[model samples]
Target: MQKHIFNIHDVVLFMTVAECFLLVIFQAILPVKNQLANRLLSTFLISIAITSACILVLWNDDVSLFTAFDEYLLPYFLVIAQMLKGPLLLIYVIALTEDAFKLARRHLVHLIPAAVAVAWLALFQIDSTDLRFRTLGMTETERQIANGVWHFIKIMPFFYALAAVNRVRLYRIGLHNQYSNFSPTEPSWLNILTLGFLFTWSFSILVHVIANTVALAAPQISDLFGIAENYIIFILINALFVNSVVHTHKLLTTKPEAAKDKVDEKLTDTAIQKVQQGMEIQKLFLKQNLNIDEFSKRINLPVKEVSAVINKHYGTNFFEFMNSYRVEEAKRLLSDNQHADMTVMDVLLHAGFNSKSAFHRFFNRLVGMSPTEYRKQNMNKEVKIA
Candidate 1:
């Protein structure tokens, strides 16, 4: 029998596991209309909890307890649970971004990896006597095989993260094409989740490498890595809770038909010229809530072709192209004595922007200065010139 080595790290791991489950319940009862996303996210969070549970078992450091657990599938579930994190998160992104998204039988394909993981465990990974897989006693070939399997598990998140990021990019492109102004903050939740997934993947790899190296010399220090990972999980879980409260509902929209990038070399230079003329000469950009469809009809071009023309010629989506013109218009207004009495909010609103934060972000990105700074600098120059 092995004595349970209780430590402070156990407290953090327990809280993380408990919070994961708690968040799942909250998602289940969350009063949002996007129940599909809510449910999918809940399942994803539960899988996270399961992963945390497996680590919690390891943190327990009790071989007697492991022997008791090995009587059932509990030991195998640690590996099985890990195989689920990637698929669950990717599908949850689909559900979150697509309003009409329905879980189809085809999505069952994701389960194949989980089944394979189970088989891999049963075949190569189970050193049944000790109820653990990796050991100092493993042959060189056995260690390589085990490391290969774990590497495959670790890399799934990266592959899924790439696909998930592409889906989100298309979704945002769709929004920006149809809506003149994205508010209250350019889908910050989706942005956070995507960046968060990437950050978590990188951070885990860094921690794993350093911990394995340190473990070679001081084995006990390895426990600290588990503690750090659990803390990260806790923080992400709480971050998701915050995002759900503030940002989840914004995802319930369809991708516009022409939003997906398609190069059209044959879309005549004349057609591209027409879009530019409409924005520059007619000042069509000043129309509040301008959309590709409306501008396409006004220019007498198909929306798809118009989108292609912008993508091909200007190297920007409709959102950026329109905002560039709007930024120009705002600059003109800001530097002019004719509109000197107008506030920054007034100038942005009149320049076709709905959200002040969104306007400021675009302004800073395109003009390399905040509106106030740009205004003051130009106004001072006008003073000097006078």
Candidate 2:
């Protein structure tokens, strides 16, 4: 029997795998309201862990352990697991960002490649243990096939990562269109995580390409390339694990009620009236990037009391309430012949909207037309009057 050799790479690989496993368990046990999203993330973590474990196993030079394990599980299983990472990540990001996300039958399409790979492996190799063992000893053709599959797996994630980043970007745009102040609604941690994942994936692909090219040109440096790749992967895994823990803790511990409670509860009708008066008299909505906290401070009211009064009297949240004023002001400006020379962008800026999209979104929702359309119609009316 051949003895297994233990090394630093094994330690790092196992440690990273353990971290991913713990994250999966944490997601399972975490008392989040969005169970589906949590489950999707847990599955993603599982894929990552499996992929990491497979890499460790493939790199292992322990003949006895490799022979024992490789018999039952073909290396093609690793390819399948890797194929899962891109789709699972895309699904997880969609689940996180889309409030209305539901797992539809169409989502199954993403798994087709993995399914095909599994079927191919089962039929050609795993169905017979001897064939699987022989495949592990890989002929030139078999090695080429395996490398082609790996190349596909490595390149596949680039597109999915791009999709995830775009999804997050669109989600932010949606938030900004709907809310005047989007800080409270922003998924900062998720955005950071997605960007980090894209960076890590891009770097990994670059390293893989470089390593493959170097290995072909000078076979002697192949071992060094492998070692460097392992180190880079280890560092990336550790960084991801650390980020997940910190962000997960924040997600779990953060309470919406705590934010609401920042407003004082003792605020009376008189104080609410004062807040309204202050808004009208001071035209606080005209201030760019005005938030509830700032408004509360200006009104000398507790944030909770201000929020409660606004909710009760205005029948809307702080953002909508403020945007209603901005929308009304925009309409007034559009209607005034004195401002006819002002461009739509100038009007939007004067109305406290930083972006044309936000201006159009609110204007359309309130006035039943886009800012440009509203301006054109109003200008046409003035021309008819003249």
Candidate 3:
């Protein structure tokens, strides 16, 4: 029996995997209200950890460890891990962005490719002993297949990453459109995380492309390329883990103060009614760049008292409360046939939104579509009615 040798690479990869595993475990044990989102994030972390482990094993070049496991199992596991990257990322993004996100039966469709890859590998293991041996030993043909599959895997995540970025983008937009002080509502960590994934994934793909092209001319350099690729993967994994830990810690540890008690103490029913009447009857929300202090002054209530009334009765901060009204007015203007000639910008400005991006974002959040789409749909409906 050959004793397994440990190297610096092995130590680093093990640490990376350990970090990811710890993150998943911590997230699972934490009694968060959004368990579904936490679970999806954990799943994403675990998938990456599994992929890192497989890469480390492959890099170690120790066949002795395979004695414990079936010959085909490792290769199948690696392929499945690669297949899962795209789907898991997409689902995780949805979990974060969608308030009512739940794993539906249709979501299983994303896992079909991984299931199919496992089935194909299983059949390969049974049908051809020579091919099984080739796969386990990483023969030239097997390596070529792997290279092709990796290219496909890299491409697959591009779409998912695009979707995730778009989701975050819209979420940010919604916040700005619905809140005067939207800075507090920003998910800076999530934005950073999504961008990091994109950058690392793209970097890996570029490295692979360059390595493969170079290998064609200098076949002997393939082993060196493989070593470099393994190191890059390890670094990428470590970077992502570190980034996640820092951001996640900030997210979990820093709890915003609930305004319930303040609202209960300072705000009266009569005051709440006065503020509501002022907002609705006077259309105070149409005042551009309105703040809590300004609104409070207008309603002749203390700032904290006004803020509490909005927070308690409206279930949103003063910023959000004001922006909701602006968004509603924007919607009405956009849908009206009289404003058919008006561009989105014109309507957004008229609706008291200084930022075009905020207008589009908030409109999409409230309507589940873009301002352009909403206008088009409404116009089409009117045309048909006529």
- Model 2 residue 65 lDDT? 47
Distance from true position, residue 233, model 2, in Å? Answer: 4.8
lDDT for model 3, please. Answer: 0.67
lDDT of 2 by residue, 316-348 (tens): 766688888999999999888899898988998
Compose the digit string of candidate 1's lDDT tens values, residues 117-184.
67876776454332434466877677666555556566666667777777778778677666566663
Predicted model with the maximum lDDT = 1
lDDT of each: 0.73, 0.68, 0.67
- Against the correct fold, how does model 1 do in TM-score? 0.78
User: Which numbered prediction scores highest in TM-score against the true structure?
Assistant: 1
Q: By TM-score, rank the candidates, best first.
A: 1, 2, 3
Off by over 4 Å in 3: 1-4, 68-70, 123-146, 184-186, 216-386
lDDT of 3 by residue, 257-320 (tens): 2345656666678888888887889888888877655677777876657766766677676656
- Worst window of 10 by summed lDDT in candidate 1: 125-134
Better of 1 and 2 by TM-score: 1
Model 3 poorest ten-residue lDDT run: 249-258
